[model samples]
Target: MPSDGFRGLVYGDWHFLEETTSKSKDSHVSSNYAYSMGIALRGAHYKVYPELKYDSVKPMLFQKHAAMSINLRNTQPMMLQNVQMKAVITKQGVFSQKRIFSVNNSKIAPNSIVTLPVQWQFDELKPGKYKVQVQVKGENDWNKLPMTWKFIKNIKVDKKAADNINDKIMRKPINKWFYISMATGGLMLISLVELLKLLLTGSK
Candidate 1:
């Protein structure tokens, strides 16, 4: 969460390759925002989270908020009356709800910073590669600025620590005998305490 009001919403996940580019290139070229592109070299799995929510229990499970932002200026910027943003998470191109933002630039300067929200949830998601696409609809055309990313399984959220312990118990019978022995010892210890209390109280 950014106090200044910039966050990276989970736009889903996408697979993409990485390459270096020069700073002098144009925005439309693959090298223009080369820094924003390329993240799919690790393997075929990555998790994408739209704007991340702060959770104390599983802080690392969610994606970090977007520190990177865009600065726009309207030089007769077509009165960008409507600004719609959306996030897509798959290669098949399934999209989330379109968040339409209304901005009246006529009253304010063109350099004002605006925050965009991106969040998503999947009913049943397995470990795999996902494409994250951020689309912004402006005055004339739709800015389908695509970025590739990865999605990995969140083991902590998906599996509980107690469940892991139970699994360990089930894996081998040796732990079961140990547990029985410990329980027996605990009972004997309790009985010994009671006997000592009685003896101290003169058989009361």
Candidate 2:
């Protein structure tokens, strides 16, 4: 006969329980083993963090062009595939016409970080507060499931400043044209003087 401790337990094809109590049926026991295992498996497939770096330290002032840096760091043990990065801009609270930019079907190796450069032209945007969102999506090594992440930032636009910048940019070509015209006129005058001197010398 088996011991009293093992009396209620069956030996064949039986499952093991850490401990048993009189009230075991009424009590609840939770284990994180499944959760940890899931995380471990997913970690081998797809895991990453997204970060955004603006061009300037100060709050962004509205201009003809705005730029930022995007970074993705893979925390997984295996390489990730079909990685896509997309940026969206909203004016006040409304979505812009379309996505600002996107990098599709990229690949990232395990524990590696990637940087993407992005630029937005806001000449048509009015002075106000705008929201910029960056999203990253990718497939795991197994390609069974997809993962997604996002980062957000707020930007302030100043029309006066933007106009000043635009004006300066516009004036540059005009200034160059003016300088070229002046040089051409000077050269023509020199040529005219030389031609007149040659003509007079020939007549003499």
lDDT of 1 by residue, 1-204 (tens): 224432222121344556655544455554522223422121122222212211112111113221112222223211232445443333222452221223332221122333333322222222223333444443321232332222222122233432332332322235688899999999999999999998999955
TM-scores, in order shown? Answer: 0.20, 0.38
- What digit string (tens of lDDT, one per residue) describes model 2 on residues 13-118? 2334454333456657744322111122233213333222233212222333443345556554455568888876566746444326688988655555665545
Which one is best on TM-score?
2
- What is the alpha-carbon lDDT for the whole of candidate 1? 0.32
Report how far residue 133 has shifted in candidate 2, in Å.
1.4
Task: Name the runs in model 2 displaced over 4 angstroms.
Answer: 1-66, 91-99, 121-130, 155-204
* Candidate 2 local distance difference test against the native: 0.54
Looking at model 1, residue 1 earns an lDDT score of 21
Error of 1 at 57 (Å): 22
After best superposition, candidate 2 residue 134: deviation in angstroms?
Answer: 2.1
Error of 2 at 48 (Å): 11
Count backbone clashes in candidate 1: 19
The whole-model lDDT of each prediction reads: 0.32, 0.54
